[model samples]
Target: MASKLISGGLFAIAFLGCLVNAQLDTNQTAQNIHDPQPQTPATQSQNTQSKSHPDTQNRRSSCVVEQQNKIQCGAPGTSATVCNALNCCFDGTMCYYGKYVTLHCTKDAQMIVIVSKDATIPNLDLESVGLLSKTGNCSPVATTSAFAIYQFPVTECGTVMSEEDGVLTYENRMFSQYEVELGPRGAITRDSFFDLSIQCRYTGSTAEALLLEMNILPSPYPAVGFGILNVELRLANGQCHLKGCAEEDVAYSSYYRDSEYPITKELQDNVYVEVRMLGRTDPNLVLTLGHCWATSKSNPLSRPQWDLLINGCPYREDRYQTKLLNVGSKLMFPSHYRRFAFQMFTFVSTGAADPSKGNQVTQTADTVNPTYEKVYIHCNVAVCQPSTQYNCEPRCFRKRRDIGESKTFTSRQEDRTVSSQEIQFVALSQSV
Candidate 1:
């Protein structure tokens, strides 16, 4: 009985152990279905690296070629795929040789020629073509499998300098050009040879310097009517008596210096005014002086003004003291120049009662305390192209037209208004 009981106890323990083992297996299978195993540290790091550098890892390196290295690599009109198959570079326009040879100018005006270490250009002699460096040698400054760079200064590399028509030209050589052939030793052809002509041209800096020296200001008026006509109104200088006021002589003088404004003049002093075209030298064009007047203020439209010229002629009130000078007839100036002289005077007040002496006023008193007033002279000038039917000369006493008449007496394209610098008139002084 005891032996049978011990055997039953052993069977029960064995059955319980099998049931525990089956429960553990079922839990393990359920967990596997719900959750996946986490990745290892090594695997996660590898995945991140692949995502960051996917393009870099997949793309092949491209060949970098300079413009000077654009020697023909294949026949004309070769496709990009064919060019790649030949191990050449394509710049979307042409197939050119890369990593073979190149010639270009440096920023410092130095010329550089580079050749690859694997390139072979038999019978090519740079020194023979006078392309030696300043050190009188053809040694490479740097050498590697990809590049053998040779540098030569533009001034010392057998360069020629010449000037023609004010243009400076610098060239490597005229007849002996830089040439090289790259191919097998005995199979070089015309297409395999590279020829380059290095040259540089420079217009001299004197033109810009001259312009700076002139310091000419642009005209305030626009180019209209007769096309860019420039008119100048100036007071005649002392040199006026010499040659009817030549531009160079009157340009700088004490009487009408450009640097001096508000020129001082005494009563009854002859004020010579010159009207001329600045750049137009056409002899057929005549300058005509029209309505000229003087105002107390700088504004031409100011009140209390005195008329010196009317209808291209001297005003009837001041005709005795105001007269047009024969500038063009003197042969000292071009036909586009006109001049007139008038005695400097002030206007009489309306109530001063000068009906007998005509409304003009002149200082006859030799008073010690002289009154001075600022005056500005304005003139209407026109350039006329003289022909059979057109006359630029002014004819007095023809007819008096009514004010605001639209009919023009002369045939002219247009009339321009020009004014002179300020003039200070001394009323009671006799000195000019």
Candidate 2:
């Protein structure tokens, strides 16, 4: 009985131990399958919810992926609206910061976040206070146009000089001349003479006759002589010597015989020719401060076209009105001078009444000689109105005498949609 009882105790102990091992295994399996345990977010696998999932490798690489809840990381192309939305923040460029977002903790135990379209913010070294205190320009939009050297100063002898040549003396006063010592007997006229000497030593042929032409009639001429109206260099002998003169005898010493001598030889030497003319006092001799616009040849005048007023004049009768294009002047004067020069700057508009509006506007820039009066300009007109809109025709031509020689300059630009009602014009002259 004692042996049987010990054997039974040993078997009972083995059975109990087996039952405890089986219970422990059952509890572990249950815990793995159905235990309601809390999971740390860091250890949770968002893609695959499994106990053995590799959570460490599943984190998003970029903020875009995280925001989009996608695993792929890269810049989105145009096809991707979300990626394009992010791109809209940039100025059609790829910035370094566009790739990812970084988070950092500070020394004060506080977290600081910085955002930028680029990896680096430029000009950040500029002081914030300095930037805040800066001011900016408050003007109309700026533009640039083609720079030009329209005309230069030339001697009465037709010698060209940079603007630096002629000394800008009493840019005022009525009667002034280039104080040069020269002899006389060249062409000297009173009704159209000037008070300046063009060192004309180029005319190998002496002026045979001093002809006088008058554009304006002066009343009650003094017995000595009628004042000068205008003058020009009639002939020249050389290419190098000065050729034109536009001043009066009082402007220089009395003319010597050499000045009036005729050119005999046809040699290569350049000759100088002096032209003396008398000029009248022009009360309207003030420098124009700004330039005027070209004329609109298409527009006609409100008044009737006059009949052939002067005999032998062409039957042509059309006066196109013009308006001002630009509105500023380049000269300043303390007072108006008695003499000046003129040039035409034509304009084209839809409602011009005078076809000559382009040549009508003038400027008082001392172009050539001070004794020279307002240079007469010729304005020719074409069709005032074309059947098609935006059609352009020859509107105006600015004709002036370069010294005593005549020349014309045509405007290259066409007026676009210029309204007749808005055309403004100002003549380029001290006197109208």
Best by lDDT: 1
Question: For candidate 2, lDDT tens digit of each residue in 75-121?
Answer: 32322333222221222332111221111111111111111111111
What tens digits encode model 1's per-residue C-alpha lDDT throughout 1-432? 000000000110000000000011112211111111111111100001011112321221224545653444446676787655433467898765454333333333444444442221221232322232334433455443344445555576566667899865555521112211111111101101112234444453211000000010100111112336678777765644564566434432434554543344433556777777877656677788778887666778876667778767787754344677766354534687777777655432333223355322222212111122356678888777666645667766545653224224465676777887566542110000
Clashes of each: 0, 73
For model 1, what is the alpha-carbon lDDT of residue 77? 74
| Pairs with backbone N, CA or C atoms under 3 Å apart (clashes), candidate 1 | none
Q: Indicate the TM-score of model 1.
A: 0.38
Residue 363 alpha-carbon offset, candidate 1, angstroms: 12
| Prediction 2 global C-alpha lDDT | 0.17
Tell me each candidate's TM-score: 0.38, 0.12
lDDT of 1 at 260: 42
